[model samples]
Target: MTASTLDAPSAGPADTTKVKRAAIASFLGSMLEYYDFYIYASASALVFGKVFFSKADPAMGTLLALATFGVAYIARPVGAVLLGHVGDRVGRKRVMLLTLVLMGMSTFLIGCLPTYAAVGVFAPALLVVLRVLQGISAAGEQSGANTLTLEHAPFGRRAFFTSWTLTGTQAGFILATVVFLAVAGLPDQTLLSWGWRVPFWCSLIVVALAYIVRRRIDEPEVFQAEQQTRQVAKLPVVELFRTHAADVSRVLLCAFIAVCSTVFSVFGLAFATSHEVGLSKTTMLLVAVSANVLALVTQPTLAVLADRIGRRPVFITGVLGCAVMIFVYFKAIMSGNVPLIFLAALVLIGFCYSAPNAVWPSFYAEMFDTRVRFSGIAIGTQIGFAAAGFAPTIAWTLIGNSRTNWLPVAAMVAVCCAISALSAATARETYRVPLTELGKRH
Candidate 1:
């Protein structure tokens, strides 16, 4: 019920000041990074269909835009491998700084790209290139932030501390939705032309602030010790596979839980706003902003509960809850009940999905040793998240023209959440484990 009942620190108490700094850094950094990421998501849902794929029918153009959303996921695994190595072999702070700058630059450039009407096929091609860069930068952002924060946090409150990384993520989504909400109200031409680009351009300011905050933080002592003693893995990916292969495998499956998010955020938005659903773009964006706002509160609260209980029960329960809630959430949209959609969105994502989202930063990070924590979490989650990236396209394709086509999308979400839950069920309960003893094979 309290910190006193939880596992005591294996090492001496981490500097409380550093722990606070790490939490704030992780929070602000993830807020900015995912702000860059999700604004693309908002655009792909609302703006990119017209901007880059106008040659296709509106429906097909939307699909192509969603496919471009998946393009980033394709590069995410590669980024994870590359950036994970840097984070593990170099230092957490370096990867943190590098990822922020990369995301900011790529997102800003996306704002500057020419549209399909202006540049022919090269429009989407250029979009894909920058999207891939965004993906790569994203590969390292959360894992880097989670690892840095987890390592710095006192043992008893690791979940609470690491949870800020995801809390910031919820804030990012809210911020993006709010920004998009403002731009979405512009007249059609302006909305599509220069209005959407404003959000992308705004990422520069976020990047500058996050970089400044991150620059002041130091790497965790555990990591610095690895460097001073030359114990940093020469190839963290290899070390991760050799030592923690099962954990990595489990985490990849567990990370499938992200499908719930993409389904709720990106796909759900597209579906709700489509002609069939007839919801206004602003309405759907409001649903998103509302749920994410609730997530800001729920994630931290549930994360505190995770520390008091254990990660597995809370995470597994939440995943299963999502499986059920997503079905209801989609049904709410299909019914064209605004009040119902709002409730479902709040519960499905704000609470049920937020549980797993809040916990995974600490949950996944605890599955590896300090030497390979970044690589292991990065490589595993990014690969698994690729499924999430394409879930919108798959859901859209699955739920074809039938007005009742929402079932397949909901079912797809249920299945992924089920897989994620089962994976967590098998993981070691790390809440009670001393920080130094985490990831022990036997």
Candidate 2:
């Protein structure tokens, strides 16, 4: 069927099936894209230190490995500006397809690159190049998907549907972690030589699948109407800053809440397993997988609650919960009880984090006019996400030989989470706004 045909209202029962199909398309696409992106993160922490930095001291090697992971974030804001403009000007569906191809190709190439032993410093140099491409591709993926899904959803259920976009992120992280677990057991020679490449290569399969699903989607009704009205901005980024600066700042501030997710998932994992604390890698990986699975369940449900209540209260409760639970989570990890560690990780990442996770899709999109929504969310979140991307390196700098030094690291996470809460507090309650009138002057 043509894109215009797919835009027609269904003859019977509103074809809940089409809406569902749309959700699955967004969900699977996000899962595949994030799986490719996060495999690098998981591998950087667990595998790259050994494979790409074999010659350096383990601590320094791990730091360098993590820094390489952060290098991708450097490109994120740039990608957000560029792709956000295209998405806003051209259409969301087109940019979604472009991001999938870019991410898939970059990830596949990473698998085929030479290792440190064979190419010396060039191995890491090539890795950094591919990572930057991955970052740029990712900068647009979630924002585009969230915007697309939210536009397509029935009113009152917008948050519920868009929550799946974040849910797909959880699925991707789970897939990446599971693959790493399997690869971790391989013989060191095989693992360093070729086994580690398997996860990156698998990205090709997912990328192909995402392309088919995305191609099948019509431009959302909201965007199509905007297009027909000739209201699409010629320069979305410029317009976003001029008219929506306050909302953009709100997004950037809320974006800082990402620290808890990154710290728990990446930094906490490394801190628990490294010689400083010496928790088993298997145990830490299990902790991550379990928490993500719980997040997949809770995020959508909490989003449903936000729809029933209001976005701000749900979001505030979540931020406050995360603030308290993170301290407990850290103490749990420090206590060295596996079950308690698992509980803490799951509660912090899976439950508390889900509160903010579920609310932000509607909250961010609601803050902008459709003309600049893509640019606003993409740029704002990318700027905010920058903290998440570099959080590990920053955490390391704050932490030294003294265990007491952890105060600085924990302080950073607390401060970021607090900012996110404050940002959410300042945002207008958008749950009642009509789709057409969103981002209008009060």
Candidate 3:
């Protein structure tokens, strides 16, 4: 094994108050950031086709709408490099608060955008613009939150603490899905006209709540001391590549596991509620809400387990399990058997997928030192996640003659999961590495 940091740099110990503050801030910030992001996902699946792409055939319009959803991924890598630089160079706290404000403004503006009928092609064009902004905001949110929380956390418990960043994201996904579930229940005319906008408009409220909670978190002590000593990297991305290139590449490949998540949540929702499947929007939405609620519970437990064992074992288990479980999960969805769909969703999303989701914040971040942890994770994961951000659209295109024939889509997920598992298997185990010693070459 490589030796830990000895002479490169050193920093202060954790504080109880700061640890609590960082986790709370990370949770609420993640909740708010993803709430803004997923609301767009829900809208693309349920309402955007009719509102913004009505000129096309129904099936084609849904395809076009989902295409717009993928547009955000194009901007995420750009955001990752830019915001990741700010987080690593300036301070994590600054980027944390900046992302929340940007997401709030963009999301609420999406609520106010005119329909295609009102403005011809400009409607979809403007929607894509705002969606790009959301993508940029998200690129930095979790990486900053994870870096901040991990720095503030007690020794030997970093995984447990860093895991909350993802748990907050689950809460955000649940809250966004529940709001859409209610809005999805409205009359078609009313739903297409205004119900969808309400969720986007409500993003302002989430922003305010997260601001109050997030503002209380100070910069991590290690980061502060490094800056005061003028030891911070001048360009985090360049330094990351020069010193930690292999880890960054590994994280990019490992992030392919997110394909399982987007396929299960976004494409699965669209498929179930399509005319071919004939499942109720309410039923599909409820399946999502229930599965996510279970994730909120299981993710933290899995994170604690990673702390006890090792990050690689826990992460590898989740990746391999998701590869197999995705087939079963979709098989149940295609069957139109309500009980079976619920059971499969609970297992695939709640436990199997949740394992990697829970552990990845720490698992990936531990690969780099404080100088480039945020940049390493943001650039690597966002580029990899670009595949996930577009997975729904790809899966939709992968569908065969009948939407019910979803075996091809399941096969696609298994391919991604396999690649992700292989990438993760090569990563160095870091659950036992001290925060100060991480990423240092002995």
Identify the candidate with maximal lDDT: 1
Question: Which has the higher lDDT value, candidate number 1 or candidate number 2?
Answer: 1
**Which residue pairs in candidate 3 collide?**
none
**Rank order by TM-score, top first?**
1, 3, 2
In candidate 1, what are the lDDT values of residues 1-442, reduced to their tens digit? Answer: 2223223555665447888899999999999999999999999988899999998998889999999999999999999999999999999999999999999999999999999999999999999999999999999999999999998888779999999999998998888889889999999999887999999999899999999999999888778777887989999999999999999899999999999899888988888888877899999999999999999999999999999999998899899999999989988888899999999999998889989988999999999988899999999999999999999999889987763588888888899999999999999889878766777777
Better of 2 and 3 by TM-score: 3
lDDT per residue, candidate 3, 1-442, as tens digits?
1123312223565346778889888998998889988989889988899999999988788888888888888898999999999999999999999999999999999999999999999999999999899989988899899999988877667888888999999899999999998899999999999999999999999999999998899887778778887889999999999999999999999999998988888888888889998899899888988988999899989999998999988888988999899999888877889999999999898999999999999999989998999999999999999899889988888885576778888888889998988999999888777777888897
lDDT (CA) per prediction: 0.91, 0.86, 0.89
Error of 2 at 23 (Å): 1.9
lDDT of 2 by residue, 358-385 (tens): 8888889889988998999999999999
lDDT accuracy of residue 113 in candidate 2: 90
TM-score of 1: 0.97
Lowest summed lDDT across 10 adjacent residues in model 3 is found at 1-10
